[model samples]
Target: MPSEPQPAPYLPDPRIETIAEWIGDPVAPAAFPRHQLRWHNRRWAAAVGLDGFDETRWVQHFGQFAPLPGNLPQPLALRYHGHQFRTYNPDLGDGRGFLFAQMRDAGGRLLDLGTKGSGQTPWSRDGDGRLTLKGAVREILATEMLEALGVDTSKTFSVVETGEELWRGDEPSPTRSAVLVRLSHGHIRIGSFQRLYALEEKAHLEALVAYCLETYPGSPPPPGAPGREEPAVILLHQVVERLADLAASWMVAGFVHGVLNTDNMNISGESFDYGPWRWLPRWDPRFTAAYFDHSGLYAFGRQPEALLWNCAQLAQALSMLVETAPLVAALDRFGPLYQQAMGRRFTARLGVESRGPEQDAALIQAAERAMVETGLAPEQFFFLHRAARNAGEDDFGTLLRLHAPTVAADDAFWRQDAPPGVLIDEVERIWAAIDQHDDWSELHAKVEAIRDLGRHLG
Candidate 1:
């Protein structure tokens, strides 16, 4: 019999080189004391034609940072500046991570393989560039949960425990260290443009804009939208639309990203870099995910506002390429787009068909009122009323009855009394099983449960 056929190798696409050299700094990966393979995203690995890698090859490339064939010979620590909590900070960049390689997925869409804790770079500043093992685990859970909930999010590609101890004020002393690799559409951020604008690199900024438009093709701004013909204006419009949808998705999922800095906002509008994130335990707009967020600038209820504010920063960057009027026109689209997105995503979460915008808004209002009056957690409320069933004979029920169920009432996911959630408590519980007992059963089970939830939602 003939031997089994081997899968074709993935072709690397180092497209970031299309931009000027000032955009990034090439650097070396840190030497690790050990490389213990922890988590491998076989599903996504298969998408990028890397599923055949064994543990040794996986550790060698991901943990040891050995350059992949025909890819970036040296990792590039990306450069950009952003406002951290609304304060401009020009000192920011890829302090702890770098672009490892680029490859097209099975669909032929360009994707990036970036690292989170692979090592330090010029942007490390006064802090050491190391990620705690627990942090990596939390990121895995966050990405999985977000992806399940239909958020456009980065895929946590790999986690390798590097034998080292790291000290941090927030985590336990001398916590375990690890390196994480994430797969994303692109790593260019709104702040990347801000950096170019700040440096007065108008020519480089224009090149970057053109590169973005070509690499991440988006629908042209709807006709009659201001400056729809201008490249900068078009990119701004696409970013606004994508971010609006993203903000709505998070609201429907009851997620608080904890941080909404301009740097954290991806140009592709994909959610990444999970830090201090939390899901709403109850329907409260003032719910915050970060302990240090004293002002609640990014509270659950204000996520849309925060995202719009970040969009304004992007507009400011693009001002160098276009007039302010068109950018403002693009910015003005966020409100209408966000409302529409909220209606659509909210109805989907409830497993009901949309009954037009006005009726959808009414249903959403009724649901919110029900949550407040009944004090039901968002997950519990959604699960209980999935397919618009079990809604009490109240205003919410009346509005829900106006819409038809999108899925069978007897669907497996809807049959459960509670929705599968990766709330903070669950995260801590899963981490405890790993940290104290070195057991991974809970983590593995939770991932499967989340995926099941995704399938049912579909």
Candidate 2:
């Protein structure tokens, strides 16, 4: 029998030249074989503007991409300071990762194409610029799942399994390495601003602030606008609003980012790193995901507070760029913004038709208490709640038993003929929307409807 040859990798539009030309970086000579990697589609990457990125070729090229003409990303060795695990660490920048370049999407949104585990550079410091295959796979799964769950997150553009083996103390010996391309707004962290503040470089801090404002022009100006005197207060307020909104989103999704270090906090307010992150299965306020979280600093219930703390760090850093009084006042708005966001999130999740702060609070508290007392998995309960209108009590009982066995004892509680609450009507509305749709489109449309309702009610 004759043997068949493998197919060549599909090369999409050779606009790689355009991307290269934009960055002025030459494509490195080394090329990883496409067969040696796991390729996944990034909807957001397509939503942005990246196309035809060969993860395998990218891994093979490694650090050589910097010197390639028309392909070299305008490399910036960012300077940043951070408090890692509560202690100040002044010398952490792009330890291994680097921002390759920025590209404008069809919608005119600027997205940064950055590389992780692309090998060592001047900032590598006593570490290897490599990411484990397991780490890469975990990141891919995390990104996909989070996006589906509607969490504001960075998209993984590509993942390439390099043929070379590396060693890591955290796992078994001779671990495989991989490269990850992430599409994000920018990599400018709170630490980046802090670094300049530490050096007392007011000019640089102001420059960074200006750069941020230019990057995210839609951001509302702080208290004092065009004709107003103090622009720093306005800038501070804008940052506070974005930070509050991001924190609220995280809380709504039950996401615990193991590390909330200043370096991990993005000024543009987007979830970036997936390291040591976990989605809460149940509504436990104390759930911690990161193994090294000895102090319970970044727990599920504490995420909002942790974010406020990070925002405080940012405020301190911005003091170098703005006045102290306005920064403090701007920072004060964190509580109100978070409260409003939380109210909106909870409202949607419960499908409450009427808006009443007291009523909403009571409903949320009741749900939380019921979830905890019943030991129900948060996701399962919410999923069942979304389907409750048509599925009937028995169906919900079956689902709860299948997905969250701990709540089996409470089947009677869930099935009891009680008066209709906020969730009941909401569930009925969501189910009605699903019922009206055809079978082929019902499942997807239903899930989306529930999610949309959750967003509005939350």
Candidate 3:
């Protein structure tokens, strides 16, 4: 494996403080009955210079909500509005979670340490601001698997089992409870801008645009892009590119985010907040992750559309600062960017060199058709025919023959009979070990195996 980056010292730079008071509200953490450290991501910890913390100190900061030195004195449950399944709702914001702190990674990229099930906030409404232990475990698995599959996603930084019994209708009643912290690129969502737009807060909207351009620093829009020099247009373009790549990564990984609300669409474009997520058991595009999504609005196939719709809403917000035409031009970039990203990521997943866009697209279509026709799971298909091997005389085989192999299928990960996967059944099995016998052995093994796959893929 490549040498890990030297850990950066704990540098607290809560840049969000500059945005003023209206952006968020101060909130208190819950008084948990107990704090038992369940999961500590040592790899990410080492990357951020927090690996030196012993178990006691780790629990105090992450579980007990003790403020890290030089960080925010109080958590901020950010204020925002979002479209929940196409219905504009002004009453949406952080309820169970809050921005705990902000720090930089070894590479100087700003990261947010955000919480889930930490406590209740004003946005909590009538619902309890708590996360079930099963929910936390599911999020950990989702992040781990998505990261291994080359998805730019949040890192599950910590999962501490809080001694509490919570009742829920979804699963067994009075289930275990926990608190989670995720390390993310940023927490600024599309809905963040939407809130300002809805309120007609033009000055605040411009300030947000400026702040994002400085802190998140992205490349300007493509040549000839309308209003390419405008900060609002540029921010929109950056989000478009990031989200397009995010959608492609999910498509290639066979991941259904389950919920694609505007609030869930992070400006950093990294995928986070995994709830009711699923991986395709077969190559079915209509696969819906959330059981409540009766209309398949955010189904696996419609993810790109949902994402584009969210981008449109962002364009609507940016219109508060810039001309509608320029923002529309920025939104226009999503389609081609998504197609290009899809081609690039698909080739990487297939372990093959691209034969240009047209050929790549053809190969992708053929491979999808083959998977659907043969009823093969995506993981199985990629594992069985990696590097263009094991492909018989079918349309898929013909397309595979056209592309050059990128890696020989000889690595230990490839040699395994079955690839490391996080399908619902596997996730339930891992959780079952933890729930039934408190045996984390299976979960730990799965994480290691997933990392091994990542190493080989690299």
Best by TM-score: 3
Alpha carbon lDDT at 29, candidate 3: 96
TM-score of 2: 0.74
State model 2's lDDT. Answer: 0.59
Tens digit per residue, CA lDDT, model 1, 1-458:
00111233587888887763888999999999999999998888877788888999999999998988888888999999998889999999999999989887655668899999888899999868889999999999998888888888998999999999999999788789999999888999999999999999999989998988887888999889878899999999999999999999999998999999999999988999988999888899999999999999999999999999999999999999999999999999999999999999999888888888899999989999899888988888988888878867899999987786645579565777687898788999999999999899999999999988877776
Candidate 2 per-residue lDDT over residues 384-431, each given as its tens digit: 454223223453333322222121223333343431122223333533
Cα lDDT of all candidates, in order? 0.89, 0.59, 0.89
TM-score of each: 0.97, 0.74, 0.98
lDDT of 3 by residue, 1-458 (tens): 01233577888889888984878999999999999999999988877778889999999999998998898989999999999999999998899999999988777877889999998999999778999999999998898888888888898999999999999988988899999999888888999999999999999999999888887888888898889999999999999989998999999999899999999999988899999999999998899999999999999999999999999999999887888998888888899999999999998888888888899999999999999998988988988888888878998898997785745677666778888889999999998999999999998999898888777676
Q: In angstroms, how far off is 413's CA in candidate 2?
A: 24
Q: Identify the leading candidate in terms of lDDT.
A: 3
> For residue 80, what is the lDDT in candidate 3?
94
lDDT of 1 at 5: 16
Q: Which residue pairs show collisions in model 3? A: none
